[model samples]
Structures are given as structure tokens and as C-alpha cells.
Target: MPKRLIAGNWKMNGLKAAVSEAETVAKSLSEQSADCDVLICPPATLIAVFEEKLTGTAVQYGGQDCHTNESGAHTGDISAEMLADLGCAFGIVGHSERRTDHGETNDEVKAKAYALTRANVLPIICIGETQSERESGNTLKVLTEQVENSVPTDLDGTKMVVAYEPVWAIGTGLVPELSDIEEAHNHIRATLTNMGIANADEIRLLYGGSVKPGNAGEILTVSNVNGALVGGASLKAADFLGIIRA
Candidate 1:
């Protein structure tokens, strides 16, 4: 099996003061041994700052999002090349919030993924079904289409990560049952393999949505669940550490 990855998505939160949390996490992990890859994707503003603070530590930082164009007249947009210049090893694309707020389509997500790959930064692709889709019993169908459309055809699976976050459960303090999570992740894995991604078996599948320390271990143990795309709990050092320790 591939090494598990625990990534914290700080979303629109955190400032310079939050660097202490990264320091704290690194300090804690250094005191013990963690057999997983740790990543923290704060807002774009903190990526460079954390990059410096987290140097030589087990913890790494990434950007919450990146633009498809290497450079352009598009203002307020950060490109993958810029992230690479900042020493970012990973970049998140097609997150649920981006899909909903920015009206991002799967094609756009795929383009962003391609841009990230070209920059040699791993893309953590996010796909999920909304509450209505799940209620209508179309979770698998939605996930399959999203995976097909969002993931590039020539993706290097070994350098990619897929996160399944049920839209209804994100920040709602609700999570699917273990069986449900297992089914979604397994379906994602099978879909990626069917799409002919290189090193498909080495792809890491992550489960996101209301993942707290209380449930981190159970979620991580589910088949095909390589780790977590943590949200709220990841903002604090102690809370993030609790989930990491799990």
C-alpha cells in the first residue's frame, strides 16, 4: 500500500499568526514517529510563509487553489507555475467550494489539474455528490462522471490524490456511515483504474467531510480510505494533531 497522506485544508482562514500551528504540528510530530505524509493547504497568502517555517520538517504546505494559465491578464488568479516557484509540492483543484462558489465545471477542474501536473505539483482532486444526489441514490453515478471529467486522461496516479467529500456533510458535522464511505472510495478507486491512469493502484483515496479526531481512525481504516482531507478540525494545532495521531 502507498504511504497514507493527511492533508489539512484551512480554507479561507489563517494569517501570519497561524504559522505557530504549523510549528506546533511539526514539533509534535518530531517528538514521535508518524508513518504518513502530512500536508497543510492554507489560503494562498500563507503558502510562501509556511513554506519557510515548515522547511526541514515532516509537514509540507500547498495552495488551496491555482489557475490554469501560466500567466495572463486574469487578475486575482494564482497560477500553478507561481505555486511551484513558491516551493509548493501540492495544489488543490476542483474543491467542492470552488465548484459551488466559482461555478467551476469539471472541464475547468481538469484543466487546472493538468496545469498543476505540468508544474510537477501533485493535484488533490475533489469529487463528491450533493445531498439531493445521495438522497436520489445516484452517489456512484455522480462520482463516476466527476472522476471521468475532472481527472485528466494522462494523469500520473502515483502523484495524485482523490478526495470524496459528501457535500452535505462538509462542515455540517455529519458523516456517512462506514459502509457508505467504503462504497464511495472503492468506486473512486475502480473508476480511476478504468480510466487507465498510470500507477492506478498507487493512487491515494481520501475521505473528507466532518472528519474529526473522534472519527479519524475509523474513517482511515475503511477500505480504499488512504487518509483524510480534513477541514474545520485542521485549523487548530491540537485538533489537527488529534486527527493526525489517529
Candidate 2:
């Protein structure tokens, strides 16, 4: 398997003082080498701050989201280029929150991913089935459609990360069974391969939604589950590190 990538999506949390937590995480992990890669995507307000804290450490930082346009009058939107300029190594696109709040579509997400690629930033594309869809036995179908439509057609697998966050499970302290997670990830991998994405098998697949230290180990061990897109647990260094070490 490829080296796992454990990334924390700090979402809209974390202030200036929160930089200390990131520093602690970097310090602790820098002391010991591991087989997986580590990253924290704080709120855009803290990206530059984390850039300083995470420097010279194994832990990297990314953006929560970016615009499809390079630079424009999209008031209140950050572009991939701006994020790259701020020293971001990766950018997240198509997160459920953005999809719901901004009514972002798959085509828009694909455009943003392509824009990030052009700016030398890897895009962690988020896709998941809603609670209703999952309850209706359409989880795989939803995921397939999202992956097919959201992922850029000319994507470079080396610059891509796919995170599967079951919409129902996020922040609700619930997770699908291990077997269910395995099936979802396996289906995602198969769908990517069928889509002709280069090195589809090499792409890192992450599981998200209420992943805590207690169950992180089991979740990470599931088939094709390379890492996690942590939420609340990531705010604390100890909790995030526990998951990373899991």
C-alpha cells in the first residue's frame, strides 16, 4: 500500500493561540518517523500561521477550500493560486459543507481541482452520500457519481487525494461498520480505475466523519482506508496524535 496520509480538516476552528496545538503536534511527530504522512488543514485565516509552525517538521498544512478561478472579483473567495502563495501544499474542494451552503456542483468542483493542480497544489476532493441516500441503499451510486463528475478529467493522480466522508456520520459521532467502510472504499477505488485516472490505485483514499483515537486504529486498518480527514478530534494535539499514531 502507498504511504497513508492523515490530514486534519480543522474546518472553521482554530485561532492564533491554536497555533500552539499545531506546534505540539509537529514537535511530537518530528521526534519519531512513521510510515504515513501527516497534514493539518486549518481555517484559511490560520494557514499562514500554521505555515510558520509546521515548517521544518513532518506535518504539512493545507487549505479548507479554494475557488475555481485563478484570481478574480469573486468577493470573499480564495483562489488556489493565493493558497499556494501562502505556502499551502494541498487544497480541499467539494467538501459537504461547501456543497450544501454554496450549492456547489460537481462541475464547479472539477474546475477548482484543475485550478489547484495548475497552481502546484494537490486537491483533496471530498465526496459522500447523504443520510437519505445511504438509508435508501444508494451510497455507492452517490459516491460513484460524485467521483466521476467532481474529479478533474485531466487530473494528475500524484496531486490528488480522495476523502470519503459519509454525510450522515460527520460530527454525529457515528461511523459505518468496518465492512461497510471497506466496501465503500473498494468501490471508490474501482470507480477511479474505471474512470481511467492515472495511477488510480496509487491515489490515497481517506475516511472521514467523527474519527476519534478510540476507533481510529480499526478504521485505518480497513481495506483501502489509507488515512482520515479528521474533524473535532483534530483540535487537540493529543487526540490528533493518537489517531496519527494509530
Candidate 3:
């Protein structure tokens, strides 16, 4: 099995003061090694500061998003190359918020993911069904379409992480049953294998959405659930550490 990755997505939150939270996580990990890999994705503005503070520590940092272009006339957008230059080890694409707010399509997400691979940064591609889709019994269909359209086939030896973040559950303090999570993850794995990824089994599938320490251990234990894409709970050192410890 591949090493599990517990990644925190700080989203549009975080300020200079939030550096202390990351520092504490780094310090704790240094003192006591974690069983899984630890990563924190702060907003783009804080990546450099995290790189400086988290260097030589077990914790890794990354960007929340990146542009499909390396460098361009597109204003207010940061490219994958620029994120790699700032020491980002990974970048997230196709997150629900991005899809809803920025009107990002699967093709655009595929382009962005490919750009990250070219920049030598791993891409964490987000895919999930909304509540209506799930209630309508279209969860697996939605995942299949997203996987086929958003993920690029030419990875060029770069391994991309896929995060399953159910849109309705995000920040709603609601979580799916263990059986539901298992089913979704299994379907995702099978889909990847059918897509001809040579290392499909080795690829990590993360479950995101209202993942707190209270449920981290149980959720992580589910088959095919290799890790988590934590949100609000990751904002505090103690809460985040508790999930890590789980």
C-alpha cells in the first residue's frame, strides 16, 4: 500500500498569524514522526512563508490552485510553474468551489492538471457529486464523468492524487456513512484501473468533507480511503493534529 497522505486545505482562509498553526504542526511531527505523510495547502499568499518555516520539517506545503498557463497575460492568476518556484510540492484543481464560483469545466481542469505535471508539481484533482446528484442515484456516474474529463492521460510518470469531496457535505458538518464512502472509493479505483493507469492500485484516493478527529480514524480505515482532504478543522493546530494522530 502507498503511504497515506493527510492534507489540509486552508482554502480562502489564513493570515500571517496562521503561520503559528503550521509551525506547531511541523514541530510536533519533528518530535514524533507520523505514520502517514502530512501536507498543508494554505492560500497562495502564504506558501512562501510556509516554505521558509516548514523547511527541514516532516510537513509539506502546497498551493490551493494554479493556472493552466505557465506565465501569461491572464491577470490575477498564478501559474503552476510559479507555484513550483515557491517550493510547492502539490496543487489542487477542480475543487467544488472553483467549479461553482469560477465556472471551471473539466477540460480546463485537465489543462491545469497537465500544466502542474509540466511544472513538476503533483496535482490533487477534486471530484464529487452534489446532494441532488447523489439523491438521484447518479453519484458513480458523476464521478466517472469527472474522472474521464478532468484527469489527463499523459501524466509523464507524475502521480496525481484524487480527492473525493462530496459537495453537499463540505463545511456542512455532515459525513457519509462508512459503506457509502467505501462504495465511492471502490468505484473510483475501478474507474482508474479501467482508464489504464499502470499504478492504479498504488494511487491514493482521499475522502474529503467534514472530516474531523472524531471520525478520521474510522473514515481512514475504510477500504480505498487512503487519506483525507481536511478543511475547517485544519485551521487550528490542535484540531489538525488530532486528525493527524488518528
Candidate 4:
């Protein structure tokens, strides 16, 4: 069975107060996490603290993004190997914010995924369309290309997870309708099947953007949505645990 995972991407958010929230979230879902994998991908600076506070707890911690290189004078770059060294079991790549703001190219994202795969870390590769693309009724077209371009050709489904986070919805507190989400996820699943992965069904496909506890149960119950890649709500432990519990 595919694991029900609620992975929080506390993107570019958090600070000293985040520790208390992280602790509370770990405590809140410690018991129920056995039913699902709960991960918090805090900024690089907070991974160690989250790991320390979540020790022996159900919540695992990771990083938002990592460089393909292991190490060197890549000023302000954290590598997958380093994230793993910090006890991160997962790494997120190709998030829209990175693609837009930092100008990360598809090849760069693919290289990053390969680097994570080599480092024994699972890469959560993100793929989605923009508001313009969706409005143009080319959602699937965009998705197929993004999936083809962003994912490493060498990666099997188990080597990474994928998030369908429409750029239009991220942080806007808006989500695609359940039908839209299901359609997108199903398309992604089919793409994986064509790749010849044995446990294609078990490879996780997460929905991101405006996911909250109040709406998690229904979303989690969707046919091919094995989990969520949460945003703003991820900042607070209570809010995050609510989604896990939901």
C-alpha cells in the first residue's frame, strides 16, 4: 500500500519560535504517525533542531532544497549529502518558487534529483502548471513536460516522490477541485507506470498548496493522492498536526 504521507514544506519560514511549534507537532502526532509518514522540511538552518526535538518522535525532518554538488565554494549552497548527514531522509526539488525566483532550470532540477538519489535521500520532485497554462486548458500538457523534464531519467519511482503544486494555488489558500487534483495525480501515476517501476502504485504523489487539516481528510482520501506537500500552514506545529490527524 502507498504510505499516506503529510510532508510539510515550511518554505522560507520559521525562526526561534518554530522550535516550540515543532516540538508540539511532534508530540501531537507521535502516536498516529504510524499510519502515515509525517515529515517537516524546514529551512536548512533548522533541520538539526527539528531533528533534535523530534528525536524518538514520529516526525522526520528534511530540507526545502539542496545543491547537486556534494560540497565546495558554492557559497550558500547546501548539498543533498550534507542534508542526509544532518539526518534528513527526504529533499524537495523543483518547487515553483525555486523555478521562478531562483531561476532553476529543468536540467538543474533533474541533476539535483540524481544527486539526492545518490546520497540516499528521497527527492520530492515537483511538477505543475501556471495559472496561464491552466487557463489555456493545457494543464496535462504542461504536467507531462514538467514530469519529463524535471525528473531524472535514471530514477525509479521509489527513488523519489512527486508533488503537483499548481503555481496558481501555492500560498494563496486556494486548491484545485478534487476532480482536478485526481485527474492530475492519475496522469502522473500513468506516467510512472510507463516507466516500468514495480511498485508504481506505492510511489507517493502529493498535492501541495493551501492544504490544511480542515480539508486534509478528503484530499488524502483522493484516489491517487498519497499525501500532501503543505505550505503556510506548516509553520505552526498545531496546524500541521491538525492536518496529520485529519
TM-score of 4: 0.95
TM-score of 3: 0.98
Clashing pairs in 1: none
Candidate that scores best on lDDT:
1
Candidate 4 residue pairs in clash (backbone atoms < 3 Å) = none
Off by over 4 Å in 1: none
Cα lDDT for residue 109, candidate 1? 94
- The full ranking of all candidates by lDDT, starting with the best, is 1, 3, 2, 4
Instruction: Determine which window of 10 residues in candidate 3 has minimal summed lDDT.
Output: 150-159
Model 4: per-residue Cα lDDT over 1-246, one tens digit each: 557788999887888677788788777665455578889898888888877787678888888899989889999999999998888989999999999999998889999988888899999999889999999999999998888778765666666898999999998888889999999999988887776666676679999989998998899888899889999888887788788877
Q: Estimate each model's TM-score.
A: 0.98, 0.98, 0.98, 0.95
Taking all chains together, the TM-score of candidate 2 against the true structure is 0.98
Order by TM-score, highest first: 1, 3, 2, 4
Global lDDT of each model?
0.93, 0.91, 0.92, 0.86
lDDT of 3 at 58: 89
Q: In lDDT terms, how accurate is model 2?
A: 0.91
- What does candidate 1's lDDT look like per residue over 36-154, in tens digits? 99999999889889878998898988888999999999999999999999888889999999999999999999999999999999999999999999999999999999999998878
Per-residue error (Å), model 4, residue 140: 0.1
lDDT: worst 10-residue window of model 2: 151-160
**Higher-ranked by lDDT: 2 or 3:** 3
Per residue, candidate 2 scores C-alpha lDDT tens digits across 153-217 of 56757679999999999999989999999999999999998998888888899999999999999
